[model samples]
Target: MDPRLFLADLEAKPAALRNLASILTVGDAWAGLPAPVDRVLLLGMGSSRYAAEMAALRLRAAGLDAVAEYASTDASWPPGPRTLVVAISASGTSQETLDAASGYAGSAPLVALTNVPDSPLARVADLVVPMHGGTEEGGVACRTFQHTLVLLLDLAARLSGEPRDVASLARRAADATEDLLARRDEWLPTVADLLDGRHGVYTLAPAERLSSALQSALMVREGPRRPAAGCETGDWSHVDVYLTRTLDYRALLLPGSRYDRPALDWLRSRAATVVAVGADVAEAAAVVRYPGDDDPYVRLLTETLVAELVAARWWAAAF
Candidate 1:
């Protein structure tokens, strides 16, 4: 069971995402509640949690009142009636998310975005947003995660009363995926060569790319057959930098504002084999660069495709 096959499978299912637009169109009625929502509480864990983080950022940027918290946090301190809880889980059966949904005290509506529509998360949600990607065999997320985030963003845009051209966005995102898949042969071999026999891997990024770091770690672990970890740029320097000398690890840095550039440079100087995504790679071990759109939502979609390409290469070589 070569995991790289999963990437190929994902590429074949590019229309899986376009199908989500229809799902959202049918589910759009949920966006038109009698009263506008006062706040949104997004809950999930691991990659699902990261998806919520990305969605929360988009919602905030659209001036939609929203916040993302771990399902455990939500379970401990639930929100009130004015809140809408959007629970995201690829496997729909994540215990923490289910438990949080069950335990939420508020009269607020519950929305679930999941690949497994029959699972418990969907059963509990007032409205279910089904992701088109099928089951993900490996523990890491690939197409499932990508579709989940995009669908959530689509829903957020519709609900926030923002002018989101879903058809245009979906088409562009699909095109980006196609572009990366086309170039897989060129970059895969290089990534595989660089990551061959590597023991530890670390991904660093700021803000939006922070979710990319988390997704990268999962892809390497589940797809590339490696033990991996991820962190924010400043946090990595303060906490994980010391471990570089003791443990053999590869670091991939995503460039952010000027604040992240200095830290990224320092990490590179420390002899960490850094790979840059969505930015220029200078003396880095490998670079998976993509043309990103100015829209944060679009940039996130592009970054995800780059990560998938890198993960597929590593998986082909290592697994």
Candidate 2:
């Protein structure tokens, strides 16, 4: 993957998001999905799975029986007429997803969510929904990842019969992303230094928006080849708290979790360096803020730009 191209891919996020919003305003890409789905099964891997899991959580909260499973799994929910299987892959060629989707070919209603309309996965589905994130010359899933989350939010709204203006949310997220890109000169260097510890980068986010943490950590690892890990804010106390005691733990905290206070408490006691993104946290060594951050959906869609940009910077430096 070319680091320069990755940076350019990131630079184009605002415009990409705006285009998606405009497209969403005109029509529903999910029109072909069968109605009265009794169970929703989302199948994907890596970034696709991350977004799918979050979408499934929202669906469950809305009282729909939904689950997101790793496409590599050997067994999953049995295919049935009332089941809707959404197989997501930005390139529409993820082998594992294609294999998993194949099992439900005739037994269940299948939908393919992909950027490439003519890809193999699209050929396998009864209906194909385009990602519309355009191309990522960077050879990474930056904009596609963002678009997937936004589209999944729309999917959740439709399935749950929840009235949400997702197009408006996409526009807001675009504004927030633009704000961050324009102001990067002011905050990027500080965040880069704070998180440039030797051990690795740790990302934490609320369970509601855990994909932010997962995608952020993935960016650091995928782009810069750095070691990074993501953890849920509340689960940090049990899982990642020990690292702070021995290592020079440096972390990115995507605030908003009610459980944040306890995790921050441990970070403070251990003198761990923390960079708070989207919201201000007094314990953090630095805070990165952008427009429309007050909206949780905006944060969910936009906060990862911080880690992505940092990964881009480090990746570029290496080359």
Candidate 3:
């Protein structure tokens, strides 16, 4: 694999998001909801599912009752006609998402968000929001995932009556990523060396940064053809910590909350190879530095861009 194709795809996200802002405007996309919506259900698969989860959190924080569910989960069906159902699919060809959309035919007006405007999901949607991430032939949804998160954030901001200038944020994201790519010599060598000898990877983050961890894990799995795990910090401690005792795992931490410390400490004690992003940890094998700004939303794009590089590094070493 020519790694340039993948990195180029990742590098295009800023422009992709800028294009997305010019193309999509929230219409009466939420018309099906009552004057005061009590709940919303978002459905998607894979990276799209991670976007849904992030959007759901933003919506909930904006005072709406929202939850994200996997498109393939039978339990994700709307509770009633009152709850708005949002089906998100990057490819628009995900069978599970299509099936969910079909199941909710007339339950309520369905909103579809996707990269391919003409995908089957868009064809049936009451409102179609395009990702505008451009064509991706790298076989991974790099720009598409970032654009999906932007669209969902834009939608949530509109719903909350506090719309933002997404284009401006996108420009900043582009600048941040371009800076990192330009200075790859500083951090890439250390991060890549720690990952090179690992059997596989497991990424953990507080719920606050789980989306980045998920995207990172996705990149590692897809780009390097290696097994990757994404887990909530606290929960992984209770149930899956036993796996750490059994295996010498390479773990990546997307740190945001102090609550992540205990899990990081436990992983370190077990001889796990730990890499921390966004913060330096003395216990970690390496720390991939990210911006220290308090705004995690802006940090998301930059940090995930780092994940893309991590995957690309693994690709270079493996092939």
Per residue, candidate 1 scores C-alpha lDDT tens digits across 1-319 of 4665676666754576667655655556245332567788888888888888877887898888887889877343355666788888888899988888866534567877788888988898777777778666544567787787777777677767788776567667776667667777877667655655356677777776578788877777767667878787877768877867765567766666445666666666676676666666676778775544445555566665655666676666666
Model 3, 42-137: lDDT tens per residue?
899999999888888888888888889888988654546567778899889899998888787677667788878899998887667777788886
Worst 10-residue stretch by lDDT in candidate 2? 28-37
Compute each candidate's TM-score over C-alphas: 0.85, 0.99, 0.88
Candidate 1, run of 10 with poorest lDDT: 25-34
- For model 1 the local lDDT of residue 101 reads 81
lDDT value, residue 179 of candidate 2: 91
lDDT of 2: 0.96
Q: Against the true structure, whose lDDT is highest?
A: 2
Task: Quantify how close model 3 is to the true structure by its C-alpha RMSD in Å.
Answer: 2.9
Pairs clashing in candidate 2?
A: none
Candidate 1: the clashing residue pairs are none
Cα lDDT, all candidates? 0.70, 0.96, 0.76
**Which structure among the candidates has the greatest TM-score?**
2
Cα deviation in Å at residue 240, candidate 2? 0.9
Residue-level lDDT of model 2, residues 1-319, one tens digit each, is: 9999999999999999999999999999699889889999999999999999999999999999999999999999999999999999999999999999999998999999999999999998999999999999999999999999999999999999999999999999999999999999999999998999999899999999999999999999999999999999999999989999899899999999999999999999999999999888999899999888998999999999999999999999997
Off by over 4 Å in 1: 1-5, 21-34, 61-64, 74-79, 137-140, 244-249, 291-296, 316-319
